[model samples]
Target: MSALALLDYASVFVFALTGALVASRAQLDIVGFVFIACITAVGGGTVRDVILDRPVFWVANPNFIIVASVAAFVVFFTAHLLESRYRTILWIDALALAVAVPAGVAAAVAMESVWPIILIMGVATGCFGGLMRDVVCNEVPLVLKQGELYVTCAFAGAGAAVVLLTLGQPLPLALIGCAAVTLALRVGSMAFGWRLPVYKSRPPRV
Candidate 1:
């Protein structure tokens, strides 16, 4: 497999693990866990593909499904061993976001689209699956809440990729730069408790 394809596969597996972790915490059954994992692994790619009018990548490759299923099953059976390592979960999530964001950007760039669409696709690939997973688990989506610099980091990385590509940088180098920036921003946000201000509505008049 190509380096980009390998990175995409790794990201999918990591995201699948994150989904299984959430489902297990929510006390979901095995089927539900697998369902969530599938969503988390492929949801972003599905959205991206639909928007780009391309065939969904996972549909064309059954290995993605197999990997997601196996990840869910492993996490389901071994959740207790992982329960106390929430930080590790967050780090893995950051890694997945880093890798997937660049992958999405590369896909759009390969299609010869402009920078704006590429950045949007990158952010969608990085954040949308987690957003859907959180909503399904009855929690505030992390990117929508005042927790950390989640989507912001994704955007920054994606934008970097676009800029580098526009500047005639090599594709692999551009992807690496984007992923590194994403990982740094995400990990820093978590480590330093960097959060955007919460939006507060005014009280109703009497």
Candidate 2:
């Protein structure tokens, strides 16, 4: 398989893990775990593919479904041991975002999409999976939360990739470099509590 295809599978597996972890946290059943995992693994890519008029990737290659199901089953059997470390989902999902954003950009670039569409695809691919996972789990979507810097991190990395491509950098180098930038910024935020400034609404008049 190509490097990009490998990255896509890896990202799906990681994202599936996050979804299964969430299902465990919510005390859901095995079916719930698998369902959540499937949606989280492919939700973003499905949306991007639909928007881009490409065949839905998992539909096109059912091996992705098998990969996600296996990931969910693994998490289901092992999640009990990691209950206390559930926050690991954040790190895992962050890494997946780094991979998926570049994957999305590459897909758009492959189609000769405009730079803006590339950036949009990157952010959607990185974020929408987690959004669907959270929504299904009845939690607020992290990307929509104030100051989380989730979408910002994806945007920065995707923007970097676009710039490098524009400057004639090789695709592999651009993909790796952009993914690195995203992973660093995201992990740094997790480690250092990095956050964007919040808007403070003025007090209501008495």
Candidate 3:
């Protein structure tokens, strides 16, 4: 398989794992696990494709769905083996974001999109899956969290991809660089508590 295809499958697997983990944490059943897994795996790509006026990716190839379901099953059976379940979820989500960003950017680039749209699609690809996962798991989406660097990391990585591509870097190389940048930023935040400044409400003057 091509590198991009491999990246997509790997991203889907990780995202599905996180979703299944969330379902397990919520004490939901097998069906819930699969449902959440599939959504988290394909939600971002589906949104990107729709916005780009392309066919939904999973509709073109059902292997993505199968991969997601398999990931959910694996996580369901192995959840107890993971001691740091929350930490695992965070790591997997970060990796998924890193890969999905380039996957989104590739689609836009293929369509001959302008740089701005390319960047937006990249961020959307990285973030929308997690957004859907959180919503379905009854948690606030991470992207909406005040002071969180989740979406910021995605934007930086997407922008980096665009810059690299503009400089005539090969797509695979650009994707690797983009994913590394994203993963580093996110992991740094998790390890060092790096965060954006939170909004401070001021009292109105009388």
Per-model TM-score versus the true fold:
0.91, 0.94, 0.94
For 1-206, candidate 3 gives per-residue lDDT tens digits of 87767878988998999999888989888999999999999999999999999888899989999999999999989999999887798888888898898888888887899999999999999999999999978987877866557998999999898999999999888888888888888888888888778767688644
Q: Lowest summed-lDDT stretch of 10 residues in model 1?
A: 82-91
Candidate 1 vs candidate 2, TM-score winner: 2
lDDT (Cα) of model 2? 0.88
- The number of the candidate with the highest lDDT is 3
Compared with the true structure, what per-residue lDDT tens digits does model 1 show for residues 1-46?
A: 8765676688789889988888887888999889999898888877
Q: Which lDDT tens digits does candidate 2 get at residues 19-122? A: 88888889888888999999999999988899999988898899999999999999989887874645788888898899999988888887799999999998
Q: Model 1 off-target regions past 4 Å?
A: 83-88, 195-206
Q: How does candidate 2 fare on TM-score? A: 0.94
Error of 1 at 33 (Å): 1.5
RMSD of each: 2.3, 1.7, 2.0
Name the runs in model 2 displaced over 4 angstroms: 83-85, 204-206
Worst 10 residues of 2 by lDDT: 79-88
